[model samples]
Target: MSFDIVERSLNDGTPVELYTFTRSAQVFRYTSADEDVLYQGATFTAVPLSRPSFEQSQDPGRKPISLKASSGLGFVQQYIASPPTDSISLIIRRFHTEDNTTEAVISWMGRVTNVKFESNQVEIQCEPIFTSMKRPGLRRLYQTTCPHLLYGPECKFSKPTFQLDAAVNITGGTTLTAASIGGEADGFYTGGMVEWTNAGVIDKRFILTHTGSGITINLPFEGMVNGDSVRIFPGCDHVLSTCVDKFSNEVNYGGFPFIPTKNPFSGTPIF
Candidate 1:
């Protein structure tokens, strides 16, 4: 048996919930309010697309959901203001009511195709996962995961031993100022990662670039108000020297540090 929740399938599921959602080093989770003690008020209304051709019998695909941002939502407003610095690879899956055991979820993976901000809401359109599968995969090229690029088994990067959290004193405009964070004004925090929580709802992340002045950040955010939570992570340039000197994990370095940049065809031979 199947019922429709916001025009989407609620097929034979005792309880509906997302399994895992990880983006930009942040994961998506629920709160207490649901029967399962989750965020019960949170709703995902399915939106269906209009049928253009009568010749086609089947539906185009599953309707897309418009991302709504309230005063305290997990996904922020500024993210929709502009596309993220890196390409988005969001993976979403839903579990049926009774099949809510383990590894029982559906795929809703897709790429953001269109975004239109409408008065307190960011309506987005995404192409289906089949669109990605239809394209040429990384068959002949060097393939690697994000963990390898950041820090993983092959990268041999060790997480810093110290704390990275900071206390925000002032927040307005694109810059954020902190007073004596972790005992370093702007030295250690430079080039580090900043994970911020806004209004206890959405979480925004930005790479803290050093401005050579005070404890000011380069990236701009929407809800950069005072008293927001911020966590910092030590930066890694991913160079062979940096790996060897700071992390001392050069043995498992994933990059070819000695690869020459000089043109291979620069030399000419005379017969």
Candidate 2:
């Protein structure tokens, strides 16, 4: 029977939901059923997961949805303990169990925005993808510091060209000791980034400080230990001097180095 007909009938169908969460190359699938479900040749593991009612809006604004899951679930610890640097997108599908061949319809699509813990459940808040399209774009700022994001298209600089190879010799909470990290000046990599593979996933963190062979990161990767290989990249302070000397890309510098410090319009600024 067709899905619409079965869905409209009160006692003719058993409906189930499938939730898929994705980030970069990682994908997690869950099924709202007693046992695992196989659809489209992929397995969606059954979990204690439920979503509140969500609606589509005619207005050009954000329509968010929330997913509540059992805290005891192992996957719940990931969001609670350490949120990923990249955004995680979600796709929900609904189909009737009465017909195995019937295709599931997409019920909702969004990206996870925040996670909250309540007693024994975790609530994941998500915002619709359309909301991002409705937001304003970036505007150029009249400031001394370059407003272009590092490694972004506007910066016109290649990140891999300045990347360095290193290995962890020791690790503290959010600090790591690596001999290669000290190859340059103390603050050469202060605003730079570091990344390593953890459990087959690429984990990244920003350098908070760099001194000698010790460097602190904004966050520590789970299970990071000594002997792990890591990639480090040098940072730019966004100054014209640094751009010319360090990166040799002053031609693409985005800041005005000679902006007047003293305003001539001020009453005492005639000299």
**Quick one: best lDDT, which candidate?**
2
True-vs-predicted CA distance for residue 108, candidate 2, Å: 0.7
Against the unseen true structure, what C-alpha lDDT does each candidate score? 0.47, 0.82
Candidate achieving the largest TM-score: 2
lDDT of 1 by residue, 167-261 (tens): 66554454555554635433454555666654343444455554332355555555456766577555666566766675677677666555555
Instruction: Please give, for residues 54-108, the per-residue lDDT of candidate 2 as tens digits.
Output: 5555742257888889887655566765788878888888878786566788877
Model 2 scores a C-alpha lDDT of 0.82
Q: What is the C-alpha RMSD of each candidate to the true structure, in Å?
A: 8.6, 2.1
lDDT of the structure predicted as candidate 1: 0.47
Superposed Cα deviation of residue 222, candidate 1 (Å): 3.1
